[model samples]
Target chain A: MNRKSKDGKILLLQGNEALAEGALAAGCRFFAGYPITPASEIAEHMAMKLPAMGGTFIQMEDEIASMGAVIGASLAGVKAMTATSGPGFSLMQENIGFACMTETPCVVVDVMRGGPSTGLPTLASQGDVMQARWGTHGDHPIIVLAVSSVRDCFEIAVFAFNLSEKYRVPVIILSDEVVAHTRETFVPPSPDEIEIFNRVTPTVPPEWYIPYEDTGAGVPAMAAFGDGYRHHVTGLTHDERGFPSQRSDEIDALMRRFFRKITQGFHEIQRVETFMMDDAEIAVIAYGSVARSSRRAVIDARERGVKAGLLQLVTLFPFPRRHVEKVLQQCRAVLVPELNIGQMSREVKRVHRNSSRVETLNRLDGRLITPREIGDCLIKMYY
Target chain B: MAEGMTGLVHKYLRHDKKFPHIWCPGCGNGIVLGSLIRAIDRLGLDKNKVALVSGIGCSGRMTTYADFNTLHTPHGRALTFATGLKLSREDLTVIVIMGDGDATAIGGNHYIHAARRNVDMTAIIVNNQVYGMTGGQYSPTTPYGAMTTTTPYGMVEHAFDISALAVAAEASYVARCTVYHAALLDQLIESAIRRKGFSSVEVLSNCHIQFGRRNRMASPVKMLEWFKENAVRMHATSKMKPEELQGKFIIGVLADSERPSYNDEYEKVREKARGISVEPKPPARFEG
Candidate 1:
């Protein structure tokens, strides 16, 4: 298909719809998923657009199969993705870990809704903020990005795919119900301006190729099916040759490297948008929909003579700890507004434990914690 | 047979290793693995284009032994992992190898859905009737009234007829075989791998060390003999109902239908997308 122009004309589309369009533009050719509340629109959009764009889409029976198909398709050398919310995301955990261990490049979009089980399927919640990092039963580094606006959803979707391909690891876009369902004007970048990442493939012949041999980029060049690479890929503690091993030192090295590669590159993956933090004494830390509320609260607080600013997190995982620590050093106190009962608040507190006073404004009634509520909390905290 | 075909088969057959496989001596999983390797050799598939995915189980270990693009995933989630691999790389021949417990119990949901979607992937379930890896625990495929370590008396639950379930779920290809009939099992697996869309071959294997010893089906020879005596061809059983074929086990292809596979349907979409213009649409206000 011909590339679309980046004109300023407004087209009304849902958050999920924008994400699908962005993914298509990013060259995602394979989509597999099972429909779930608040996130089904992403699948619906893909179901319509993928086939028409020379891409593939399959409605899997459940979240587990959805994840499996994406992984399998990725191995066959396609840019693949899947979308889910809450319970479905929970079911995808183990395989998510497998994607991590095997270093497979793929994108997983979680449209967050209130949840412990099926708590509130149609409501917004940041409860999964921490779960996105620790849900899988292993110690592995992860890259998670949160979208606070409809425009950010499209931009972040493309970025998520880029990071997944660049790092050769699963990258997650954490979109809550508020952002997922919300519609906004998004001027997509011109085709030439759009950045894309393709996984590094092996240059050697199949016989000499070792799937897991790190090529100094902290990522091994991959060889998908039809590339004539007869190498094995597994979740087991594999040796450099990709064969399962039982040796303790080998296991330790593999696990250490898996964590080290992403952890070491934290600066590259960490992203945040600071608003008026340069001269503020009090900061409101937030992400996703809560960030939207905090932005307005910060603006009102500033006008009302309160030195309140916003530290909006765009990349959730790796927690942006370094930036939080630096901000805490200058600020007297920080207010965290989240949809869940203090999920990201705990992270903020943990990171800036004794450096600053961290207070939380939490809501879990399946409603967006309004800017007025956050503004009131800022006033009470500062006064 | 043609010289080229024979050479291709010889290339995949792991001949350097002798009869003593890595599996436990009485493990029926080895038989299932044997049948799979033989199937790949017989079909003459390009080793480079074939990928094997497995979950955590005694049978899950099959990927490590086989020479192919093997992926050993987490417990009870092999199908999910394989689904991703297959969808991303349509050119690769994807196969899911799991135990009865892995496929029908822990991973049961994935099985039905994969079949329902008719994805172009092969699911090889090695049904040993028990969870061999975690001691002899009863599995979903464990026959009713069968003795297990967990079920000291007999299993109270009825076994899932996986073949029937797959057929009902709209799987395009479905078949059943036992380790006893090596040649037939090989043929079934080979054909399933070659089939266009979601195909499943349930290999009723033996966990001689666990299930067999508990149920007095201990000897490997006896297990093979039981399969020979019990399993009847689908053609032979068609004339009879469930009552007439009461004690006999039915084997061979149970379902084979033509349907538009996922890849085929997806291609049509891609073609349409290609023909469309890329004129950017105007951005609009997003409302919740």
Candidate 2:
């Protein structure tokens, strides 16, 4: 597992392996996670790699602790991450909210498996689409990215870190069982090829550093613990000076800034791939591994003389409403093929002006919705 | 205390922040906090290099007033956060403050596992016997048959002897003292922080407003008196029979031994992973 040469050498790598490589490349210095099926390889790879790179990898007591430790390391001026599946993801929601409220920059990679509970372990599902957005309670902001291919895993892991650091928010990478376990030929990006983003540190003296002051950009420079700033970070609603505040104005300002930072950076944060969308009468909007199948369906449909295109969502939350809306407007009908029962279609339908124009092809029995199944749905909707 | 010592302790407080504090008058949380500050001051610790991590409870508020690198984290999860902080910044002295319920109830798994992991950090479990901030509910350390809002008919569960739990979990250092024993509190906490590996100090403080009122020890003074009378010094406990020890608790160091802390061990792990061998430094507290 040496650092792959950047000489365009195509090496077969699992999605989880690529993600771990990307995180290390993106400067993730600490990883604390619990082992879960489909996601364990990410931790396994990190455990093998992080320590050798002078980074730390710890198998925390549980997912809750894993998320907690990641946030703690991030606050200590290190980029940190944790990976888990559905049940573990549920346990991590509280600390995810803690990261949101305190504006801690960290990455949470949720390798999606089927569930409301322990539904599936060795299976894939996009069921956590909603959970990734609203899993943590509260009206908080989050950034979520989905990886469809092994290459996307490496690139998206880096992208997730950048978004988290820039916004001081918890970024979630949604990779399902298929994407995580699938191995593909990937050319590792050279160090010079990847752009890394680190959180802005305060330039002011320790006496003048205000931990949470909204500095016009809605982002306050962070000072790590033991850096002489000696500032307070808390889960409670805090004022500009980072002390807990009960004042309505301060509370309102904090909430506004949390949201405004992401909303204003929407152009930078939102990413979607429009494939063969031009001159198409019908569109299929999908994400994660299902998007790979959807792309095949669209290609098969086009060969059969149907005016079909694919809208692959690389970023899932902040909802990607603008891209979905455009696809909806341009195409007479839209099909969303996913492993869950209408989880993502619910979002597409929300943005589609005409509700009846959008339909979903769902396969929920621990199996993937194949290209043929999706193509049939698209053809039926076309007719 | 001398005027000079008082000034040193006050220097560690965040004066310009929210003052007058949030504690109800006579609550023992302030006393435990005072003990902690004095202990740190005695050790001559640099405020900048000490991180006070606390979980949700009345005890958690102590981090807010401490003029150190403070983190007020989620309930029952301060140790988890401190574990990460210490692993990354081994130079900082990490001290975790949690309450009875915060440590033993919702956070029980972390409490035992943190001890087992033996990370170099001091955990001050301010055991007030009930959830004071959330209104009096029976906590894990709440005395059996003690009445509370949720346990009006008295509690059915036996109390957790927290210090014993730590000792059983093989923590490097473990001690117990009541807030009534303020001098002992300072001594035990100072030793716990100074020692390497996971150290736990169970400070039996009073939540008179909640736990005390139901048990007829509502006055902070009465609770202190109960602690004073019932707590037998560890040395003296050896002379007492099991029957004589009934309804009494022990105060003093319950466990003390040396072990490789998690941070130091992880450093070795890093060395192994990198295929590099270096002379390991003797385990000692990092000088600020």
Q: Best candidate, TM-score-wise?
A: 2
- Estimate TM-scores for all models: 0.92, 0.97
Error of 2 at A93 (Å): 0.2
**Pairs of residues at least 3 apart in sequence or in different chains that clash in candidate 2:** none
Backbone clashes, each candidate: 35, 0
CAPRI class assigned to model 2: acceptable
Reference-based lDDT, each prediction? 0.82, 0.91
Candidate maximizing DockQ = 1
Assess each model's interface with DockQ, reporting 2 decimals per model.
Answer: 0.53, 0.43
Misplaced by over 4 Å in model 2 are A1-3, B276-288
- The ten-residue window of minimal lDDT in model 2 chain A covers A1-10
CA lDDT, candidate 2, residue B14: 86
Off by over 4 Å in 1: A1-4, A353-355, B1-10, B13-21, B238-244, B272-288
lDDT minimum window of 10 residues, candidate 1 chain B: B279-288
